[model samples]
Target chain A: MAVTDEAIEKIKGMIVSGALRPGDRLPKESELASELGLSRNSLREAVRALSLIRILDVRQGDGTYVTSLDPQLLLEAMSFVVDFHRDDTVLEFLAVRRILEPAATAMAASRISEQQIDALSAQLDKLGDSPSVEELVACDLDFHRGIVQSSGNSVLCSLLDGLSGPTTRARIWRGLTQEDAVSRTLHEHRAILAALRDRDGEAARSWATVHIASVEQWLRSTL
Target chain B: MAVTDEAIEKIKGMIVSGALRPGDRLPKESELASELGLSRNSLREAVRALSLIRILDVRQGDGTYVTSLDPQLLLEAMSFVVDFHRDDTVLEFLAVRRILEPAATAMAASRISEQQIDALSAQLDKLGDSPSVEELVACDLDFHRGIVQSSGNSVLCSLLDGLSGPTTRARIWRGLTQEDAVSRTLHEHRAILAALRDRDGEAARSWATVHIASVEQWLRSTL
Candidate 1:
């Protein structure tokens, strides 16, 4: 095994076994290198890798500490990769989201708080008056995110968020400029909010399915 | 932004803009460092981060190269994070698989080739006679993977496969020691195959929905 990889694994082991909990600070570079039996150069490589995944939070002039280890935070690393995908991959991702978001909505139906439903409705209302492509993109993300957050499935919410990143949203927004995508988007959001308010799992699932399917259909014909 | 992050974005930009093609060999570290206006040490950090996500393939004695950039390959990195979840997170992931795999199965109904079905059948046949727990787990992955690949959506296949990784599978396998799981699993696999062979998209979806939900029910009960 490479010395640097060994250090990465050793540090991961410490975190996994609970020796290094979230928010714990690491030793100084010199001492950590000595303890891990690696040179400072190799240890730096290990730290760099971990930091990229949000496992280790590094700040200039500040000590490195373990991150919160939340699924949402760790999975944010995926956004970088998602940004690199090209045109067809965006629709492909939306198709998968068509499957996931609806399922997540259905799960949220039973448990979505009244406050959460009102919040989503208000976001929809705020989005109703006027929306540019950029505003539509932001609104679309928040509307979906609000429901997924209420699903009580942190990993599901994180993975879904990680998969549909800003770059893809921009592409969709660019495509959505043909018509009043703002109205369509708000309409879909309202339908989903109504389902949640009714506490109807199947209705919520169906609404989300139709909503995303419309977007997917529009994206397909545009391509 | 940090020099390392800028280097990462520059490299990714090159790829996204088609300046770098999939499977293209990257410039030597020294050359790439000079081009990006960063020192070798800084560039190494960028490379390590990309490599972790399978975007860059680094060879020890050889120069670094761009990966195939296949969605399947990139999504594999999620397994590294998936390795850490130890609680109800497993169920959350499975719920995602429950949505995706069935939808993929339904898509496969139209596109799946005769040869593809045969391969899947053969894979199931190998597990027909009550395989060990390890064997069962491997078969389970292969069964779902086969269906997803046939869906003709590489992004969806990769996302579903990455979300339902082996680590989560191992946990479910460890807990499914009862003899009932043996027959129930085989039964479900057969039913799904039957639906596929019949070219019944709805049936395939329904069967898979029931199949995974059974396991999900078991998991929820235990939780």
Candidate 2:
């Protein structure tokens, strides 16, 4: 392994073995370098790399410490990575989303609070008929995010969030080019919200599936 | 933004905007640094960070280049992030897997070939009645991975692979401590394979679900 890789693995060993618990401040650079038998530069590079992935936090004047290592935080790295995906793979990403979002919606059906349902309904109402493409996109993201959050699985929520990046442009393009796309989206969102209000998991799941499937079908045809 | 973050974002913008296409060599460090108005150190750190996430590939004695940005390669970073997960969150990870693997399995039923089914069956048979815990874990991973790969969604396959890291130890623990767990797992694998052989997507999905739900049930009780 390269010197920096060795430095990274050593630090990862510390974290994984529980010697360096989350939020634990690291030893001084000089001390850690000597202890791990790595040069200071290699150690610093490793720290920077880990911090990029949110595995560590480097405060401006404070010591480097491990973050909470929450699935939400760790999987946030995925969204960053997803942003770099080439356009050809958007459908693959969407296929994964189609599987996940419906399950999340169904899970939310059982667990989503009445207040949360009302909140979602209110947000949908707030978007008047015939909103701009940008407004629709933002509301679409928020609406699904709200429902997924109710699934009570942080990992699921984070994965869906990460997977959404590559497909966002597809959505925007669909809205812009496909006449009646906006109305279809609005109608589907209302149907989903109604299903949730009725606590119908199967109906909610089916709605979420068709909602994403329509986007996938359109993108596939265009591609 | 931190200097390195600014540097990272500048590089990211180039790729996202299509100026830095995949496999394109980065400009010479000094020239690019000057062009971005970044010091060499910040640029170097940003490059290192991006490389760590598989966004950029640093070749020995060669130039840095943007990676293919393939979903598989990009999401490999998730498996690394998952390694740092605290034990308390393993269940959340498993829940996400439960949602995904069954769906992937169902997709596989329609697409999986006779040869693939034979190979899966052969592998399972090779692990005789008295397999070790390590063998069971390896086979279990290979089994689900084989099915998910047949699902033909690289993002789904990669996400499931990344999410599996946390629950691996849990699987091993259940195998070692829980009576009949190994036999039960083997039986479930057979059922899943049989369903796949019959090309029954719903049956495959249910078997996959119950298989994971059993592990989840066991882990929940222990936790």
Per-candidate TM-scores read 0.92, 0.94
Quote model 1's TM-score.
0.92
> Tens digits of per-residue lDDT for model 2 on B63-158?
889998888888888888888887788889889889899999999999999999999999999997776767777888899889999999998998
For every prediction, compared with the true complex, DockQ reads 0.63, 0.80
| Runs off by more than 4 Å, candidate 1 | B128-130
lDDT of 2 by residue, A63-142 (tens): 88999888788888888888887768888988889999999999999999999889988998898766766777788889
Indicate which candidate wins on TM-score: 2
Interface RMSD for every prediction, one decimal? 1.5, 1.0
Off by over 4 Å in 2: A166-179, B166-179
| Candidate 1 clashes between residue pairs 3 or more apart in a chain or in different chains | none
Q: Second chain TM-score per prediction?
A: 0.93, 0.94
Q: Cα miss at B140, model 2 (Å)?
A: 1.3
By lDDT, who's the top model here? 2
* Per-candidate count of clashing residue pairs (backbone under 3 Å): 0, 0
